[model samples]
Target: MVTAFDEALTCLKDEKIRITPQRIAILEFLTEVQTHPTAEEVYQAIEKRFPGISVATVYNNLKRFTELGFLKEMNYASASSRYDFSLKPHYHVICESCGKVADFYYPKLDDVEVAAAQLTNYTVKSHRLEIYGICPNCQQVEGE
Candidate 1:
């Protein structure tokens, strides 16, 4: 499997985004965390290892990566936004109790995309899907 860091570098090159150490660190953190981290969370983690990097840099890089189609920005019912490095057609299962997230892959989405393309006059560029529910842990805790 291609490592997330390598994927990020390739994405940067493809989008003609400058590849700097700070950007790489931000990308690496996004890849490793896989928790759909917030900008503040990313900044705090990167700050510990990288003193000179700023919170603004983290936010900017996240936006650039999203434009490059390498990362997806997710919004919950809560106030804050989070970032995910996985760009493929997949859905998210979010835990309501603890706020954990899991990625779900659905092959049927390709068919759905085709149907949507035929139904709409406008081009269907992309789609986002997320399901919110209580996780197993939360269920177990509630059972107690």
Candidate 2:
């Protein structure tokens, strides 16, 4: 059985990108974290293990991973951009109250893209959709 980690590593190998320490730690963090963190958060998590790794290193590796189709970059308004490694078809739900991000998958949206392409008679390469609302924790806190 091929795990997500295995698939990611395989992609790196296929892309001929060097498997450096920083890249390993970065990929590990992205594979382990579901929170979708910025490069700063990624650096903070791995800095103890990689004392010499810089935030710039994290950003550069992330950019390479994205270019190689191993991940996606999400820009949340004015905040530092976060990286997503879910590596599947889905959209994002952003919490307005606490700035949390979560994945949401809707298979029907695939057809929406086809419909759009037919209507415009133009090729639709891709799309991004983010739904913002108060998250459950925030709602519960306000209820209390």
Each prediction's TM-score versus the true structure: 0.78, 0.88
lDDT of 1 by residue, 1-144 (tens): 888678879878887878888887887788788588889999998898889888888888888888877788888986678888887668989988877788899887767767888888658877777799998999999999
Q: What digit string (tens of lDDT, one per residue) describes model 2 on residues 46-74?
A: 99999998888988888888888878889
lDDT score for candidate 1 against the true structure = 0.83
Q: Supply every candidate's count of residue pairs whose N, Cα or C atoms clash at under 3 angstroms.
A: 0, 0
lDDT, candidates in the order shown: 0.83, 0.87
Superposed model 1: Cα runs more than 4 Å off: 1-4, 13-18, 117-123
What are the per-model C-alpha RMSD values against the true structure? 2.6, 1.8
Q: Which segments of candidate 2 are over 4 A away from where they belong?
A: 141-144
